[model samples]
Target: MKPRLGVPSDLEAVTSAVIRTMPLDPQWDYRFPYRHQYPADHYKFTRMLFEYFLDPSFDDWLVMVAEDSLAPGDSISVVSFGVFDISYVNKRRHGPGYKPQDPVTEVENRGGKTRRDANHKHFNEFWKGQIRAYKKYFAPLGPEQMHLQILGTLPEFQRRGHASSICRWAMDHVLRKSLKDMSVMASPMGYNLYTVLGFERVGTFYIQVPGEDERLVLQAMMYKPKIWETKTTEDGDGACVML
Candidate 1:
């Protein structure tokens, strides 16, 4: 039978599995410092984000798992990503949304206005600035827009089709609802998998290793599926649609 498809109901198990595999998944190790703003024990970081960013928000996020079948202990593969509802937008300078009339956000208060529109105004403006500052390297985004938060597989389980399963599963789920385009910052190991799934390169990002001077490079990949390609198949067979 196919492995289950829900956020891992057990918080600890889910975090443990993902963290234990982090070294083998360097993007996780490299992105960790930036993701939470401070150093965190691998498992603790995964647990905190899973509980806060993913678990309770099932409607907007999907966390899928593949199990051992026999041992069936923790997941062997974990992919956690989400789609922002139409109402949501990205901002570069804003924090989370504030109440419309909060004491802080009155139009008279410029700082409050900036914070209130972080995801929308701040993000749009930020991208514009990035374009101006990095014109030689930056390229424009295409019509579709979606983001891939994370995808990882234990090294022991690599090449068993687990990675492919996770990508196809998540993409199928979004496409069935006719989600806008999807995107991800792909690690070197992940680039091939995304390409196989029809995502194309759009840009790149570089990050310095936490304690080293060397920088690691990542590709920004995006996909805009043909509207008619709304069907999902397991291992490329048996068409089904995921919600």
Candidate 2:
């Protein structure tokens, strides 16, 4: 499968796939319990988040989707996707350019707070806390590093190298642009894959759910470009070694 840049038109399908694949992650499931209980509400919220990602003004981010077809067609199935940013510092500085309007005020102006509204507020706060914690500890390797915000493959399409392919594409782009490093907060399910791709574990942290007993463990991993050289020993043996 080849990896292609994702467009705004692919947002809905990609978001749906994300909703399906993300809960396969223990942390996502724990954070968004509504995904299993109230799928409709979950889908609505997920779509909103993806919409923000796909906004035209948010050009600092790159969304890559892996497609099965060799040629262009009317419709393409996105088996996997990776969201990358050239630099997190730039993203933070420019921002998404759109802030969500007050939903509670709108609802209350029309009527009283509904249970669904309350739930949405609670979940939003929960996620905001997560973001705050992430920002608190997320110190980039340098201004030259690229950040992998998220990466996932559909369950049926996983283990077929789709995720690896997308990762390789992004890493190549970073290297070509002379970026010094790449980084990601890897889930347990993806930790091994990232390691095999040469991302070294720098540290680990846990996300504390508001009222839940379980905390989500995330591995902080980083990759720096390495130079390898071929050398011949005095015995006439040749080997590849890091320079």
Candidate 3:
């Protein structure tokens, strides 16, 4: 199945697919520490995240979804999804319609703090720390570089080339726009895949929660546009280099 540019209407389906696929990575599982105890809150946070990505007002980001036709009807299944942030120069910019204050206030306005509220607070701190570390250790290639924020394929759809298709789509867009490179924070499971696509590991980081036993490890990877190499091979023919 081919991947297509996603629209606001695809928000719910894409969010569900993301939540389903993300746990396949140990890092995501460790970061979303409350998933088992508070499934509803986990879903809510995931939905809000995708809503921010899909908001039409946010032109600096692009979302692509891979789908499978289930029948003769128009129904389809989302097999994989990817979100790319197009502006490396505006590195600190947030999605247009996403107001971090609103969510924080909303949670506080509920009077007493619930488990969900605590989870939100913990996750925010964790996310902020990761961003700070990223900024400290990794600098953008240039104004023309792009960031791959998230990419995942449903477990059932793994090895089907869904994720690769979306990745190639982003690379093609980068080439057309004359962008210099692309970067991503890759989980151990995805490290090999990104390496095969020509992304090199620049650094690694580990995220550990105060009371948690599991620590999440991630690799920072950067990919430069290699149009000449891509042109000589069939799409999605890149080799995976296991580390």
Stretches of candidate 3 off by over 4 Å are: 69-75, 88-122, 209-214, 227-243
What tens digits encode model 2's per-residue C-alpha lDDT throughout 139-232?
4344566778779988877788999999999778766676777888788999999999998887777666468665667887787777657799
> How many residue pairs in model 1 have overlapping backbones?
7
Model 1 bad stretches (over 4 Å): 1-3, 31-40, 57-59, 70-145, 209-212, 229-243
- lDDT tens string, model 1, 1-243? 243454546566567666656556554444443433433433443465565433443333445566553246754434332222211122212334411111112222433222221223332333343334233332244222345556766666667676667677656655665656666767797898899888889777665423656455667777766666346465766554433
TM-score ranking from best candidate downward: 3, 2, 1
lDDT of every model, 2 decimals: 0.50, 0.69, 0.71
Instruction: Name the better of 1 and 3 by lDDT.
Output: 3
Backbone clash numbers for all candidates listed: 7, 0, 0
Better of 2 and 3 by lDDT: 3
